[model samples]
Target: MNKVIEVQKLSISSSQGCIVEELSLSLEWGKPVTILGETGSGKSLLAQAIMGALPRGLEAKGEIRLLGKTVECKADIEELWGREVAMLPQEPWLSLDPIMPASKQISLVKRLVSLLNKPKSESIAIDSLARFGLEGSEGKVPSQLSGGMAQRLAYLCATSAGGRVLIADEPTKGLDSSRKQQLIQLLKEHSNKGALLTITHDVEVAKALGGEILVMKQGKVLETGCCESVLNAPKSEYARSLISARNLDHQRGDLLPNHKVLLELKGVEKSRGGKTLFSNVDLSLREGEVLGLVGDSGAGKSSLADVVLGLVQSDKGSVVHHQVLTRPKMLKLYQDPPASFCQSITLAKNLEDLCKLHQLDRKDIPRLMSELSLNSELLNRKPDSISGGELQRFAILRVLLMKPKVLVADEPTSRLDPIVAGSTIQLLLEQTSRINCAVVFISHDLELVKQVSHKVVKISDYVANHSSELSSPLVTV
Candidate 1:
């Protein structure tokens, strides 16, 4: 049969309301399908419902067919895992075993799901990682690898089972431009042998995949057609805005940062596992300025950010803040929102603790949530219960509540859709300007940094030596 996956009248609802309503679609082998939507627009809920992995308190109703055979609604889909279907998640590192070495994780999936012999699986795993430019990372655990490297390892594990159908949710989130195109090519190759369903906010990815496209908003499909039609000549206003956000430029930010220096790094040097990441780094961040940091995947951008925030110590040199800037007054927004919060506690409880610790007013949350487009109800749910985008916005709210003198935002808007991302960046600039907070904004998207940062630094420009196992640079633009 040509069809690998089909869903009819799929609906997902929670106590708050229906998240994904009456969605229907069909996927055929040798072709790919892409779903693009705003944050909290039910793209992820659909994927979970299809995989029979929806979180507790959510109910799904629909009929799913695998290889043209019908399955019960909300059926236990364990039998379909690996050999039938596999998923690459947004927070891929969360899916990987923290203690398992990179190569072993891939081999384990091959052995258990594809039923390959141990030696054969091991051989294939190493070869596969090399192809993905993870050759020297075989022994690295999830925590040891950079976010992009970890994401690549997770992808290897997901596809190792030879699943005929793949569901990739935000698969390219942490990748550099080159790595993103590489992964997209691999996904296209997978479609040649199976069916691929990609849920993402990146407009460029959907365009490159060149397949049927669906644009959803508020849990409803707003536009559907071939990629060219929906993206090029979109009938929906929101779709047009989404496409235009990619062309965002430097006009939105300050051209010169003349304010007082709030934080500075002097003769900084750091190395990991006998490999140098960056050295002799010097930079100054001024009040109300957005200092942008950009680099290829696996570069020491995050490490440098940690040094500035005092989360990590440098091997040589020092990080100093103005006397007014104290430990509690400097905060960092992590790359992964889920890892930043307590998974077992409700969002509200987390906020309550933050408020009590700082002796801040709880009334500020609602106003800030409104500014960030976060719903009041999300606070009642645990971190695991909310969508990635929603949780990311909540993370922003948390940082905004603190009103720090220095805010180290690591890819703050990476998880948001174009529409939401545009507004969110504007809000950050406005609020931070009002509070005179200096920001160290780390991102893989250099264009985004240019658009919103007062000054920019490319880590690649400062690298002493270049290799996959090591990369990092520091220079002030």
Candidate 2:
């Protein structure tokens, strides 16, 4: 076996405390290593340390050997990027160049790193785009594409340089089932030629990648073994729960109580980047009702949400909200929880500001926190200091305090581990139910949508299909 990356006693700590503790592992050529963990388990930190890309405040202590070389600092590993190793960061959509066309981004990477001619680089870029079902999106910029489309482009660019070892951090965050499967397969094939290291919260991805597995929690490895053994017969409690969350079958049956309609979309039609995403769409969201929206990536799910929330105007439709619902009464839980919070300040400060602006009673905080299982001390920490799951809980808590009439959650739990995701969703359903709030839940996971929604809508049914030269359909997200 050819060993490419070796590590010993790797630890990452921040001013708050230890983030990743004394982790050790080895990666060999043509074999994949998958790290499965919750949001705050230090998975990303480990990958960053390996890449010498840890943030400024974070401190890392460890020994990393690559290609029989001893790298000492960021500069030591700088030259190795794209030549020896490459990485796909979390939420890759945000990392893509906003002004550059998708195909040009891929072609530029191939041209710069692979040293290919213009024609060949462009040809290969098109092929790579087709490989990930992103064909015909060549001319579109990142913002002009859907969340999943941008993520695919980012992966193509990251791997374009023929990096021998690929580190993907939550590579499948915004993807639907088909795209997630295609990506895992591509990563598998890449590992056949080089080595792949994937850090994810998705259990299905770990099961499908089938090589070595590491189950991490709060900066510690609790389980490690062959993928089949570790997943099929997981020994750790957390690991078992992670897998269980994926396998369970249940539903949030008929939570509606014939309440008044909170919002209505009549013959809605929307176009982005000179292309139609969906047309002639009609939907009604009622008080205390949960409407689940499911569709392929780039199928205008998020755009529909915006239309309902009045964030985006539909080209040929009317969105009428109940007179009782105002801007503050309508809330949106974002796909990325951290985006909803003010990163510079403490969580408590952010919540306090909201409370003071609305003249809310501070006593409501404790009751909501208790119901959501959120600790009071978390308020003292900054947004970046807490886990994504906790941050999302706090986001919900913030919304609950406002007593919203309608909650449009856009892929709210896509980035979370199955276990915490399950809990967070449960908290959402329970809290909204208590508030008698209407919900428009958008998700890529069919099972999750089925379990939690009162009725599910396939947005593709309303989409009007048209071909273009890299139409670059900006399905709203």
Candidate 3:
């Protein structure tokens, strides 16, 4: 194997401070490497640096070699990007051109590698799509495709062209288990041709790749070794902590005796655009009880949540509530906290405005922030300046001030690392338990569901009673 990408004493710094400290890495042909870290650990920064795509105002100092070629400037390195190196961005759907169809995007990549004509490129695009189990989807734009499908398309664009070094950033972020496995296989196949580097928070992905693993934290590599040795027997305490935090063997106590029903849905039916989303669904949530909802993406779990939160009404059937429901009394924590906040304003302004609108006391804000282990100074920063996990913790603090009877959290930890996600879920449980708030937890991770939920329900089965149903099985824990 030959060295494809080599970095010696690489450092990246921004106006605030040094984001990535002195780091060194080497990836060789026919080998795959993964960098595992919590959010804001500078993993993605290194990826961008390797591809010469660093953010504006951030500069790199060190030596980077791609296939024995050295470049003096970032532009010089990027000149060789499309032909010698490729990157699969963090968000495939967003990275893809919204106006262009999938077929056109694939064709463009083919044209870049080989000056293929329109008809020939289109034919290759169709055949490539079929290889990824995405046959007949060439005409649809990224918006019309699901997250899994879009990720597959992104993989195609990166690898189908002639590139020797591939950098994948959280490639399996929103995929289900089956799609994730498929992605791992595809990565393996690509590694056979060239060097592969994966940046992710997913432990399973790191394990499946069966290659060298770098455990990073706060821009430094804490440990490095082969997959089996490093994960099963990590050398650093931080690495050990990360593995222990993802453990899902916690015991749940028995349900509260004579528990009061907080929220109930009976025979709920919802439809849109002459298509049935779900029908004949029933769910019950008792006070102090965590009810886990498991299903594949776009499986009507979010729609059911909308019905419960009164954001959308069911076409048929009913949503019954024993307790009085108000804007503050019932709150929903969104999947993406950045979307929830006004990006232009600082967190302090957002909090102040939210308090005024909800008639919440200003004094309670700092107290909840303390409980969630959030720094008060962070409140002065903009949402964009904070990490995703930290932003989610901020969102949790906002809802805690309301002292709601029930909390509906949708994919709260889907984008987070296992350790951070575990801690966040535990904090939510601890706080909500103190208030005896019923929780409706929706997620794709079944192991986490089993550890947290008092009772688990499969949305696939509930919707199967309708005319059209989910094509997957009812996974329960």
Query: Looking at candidate 3, what is the lDDT of residue 22?
Result: 95
> TM-score, each model?
0.93, 0.88, 0.82
Displacement of the residue 405 alpha carbon in candidate 3, Å = 3.9
Name the runs in model 1 displaced over 4 angstroms: 73-76, 247-258, 465-477
Mind giving the per-residue lDDT tens digits that candidate 2 earns over 224-330? 99999998999999988887776334334345455778778788889876778888777777778888888899888888888888888899989877656788888
Q: Compared with the true structure, what per-residue lDDT tens digits does model 3 show for residues 30-110?
A: 879999887667887788788777766788999988777764466767656656788887656446887788888889988
Ranking by TM-score: 1, 2, 3
Clashes of each: 0, 0, 0
Instruction: Give, for candidate 1, the lowest lDDT window spanning 10 residues.
Output: 467-476
lDDT of 1: 0.83
- In model 3, pairs of residues that clash are none
**Considering every candidate listed, which one attains the maximal lDDT?**
1
TM-score of 3: 0.82
Worst 10 residues of 2 by lDDT: 468-477
Q: Kindly report which residue stretches of model 2 are placed more than 4 angstroms away from their true locations once superposed.
A: 111-127, 247-258, 342-349, 361-391, 464-477
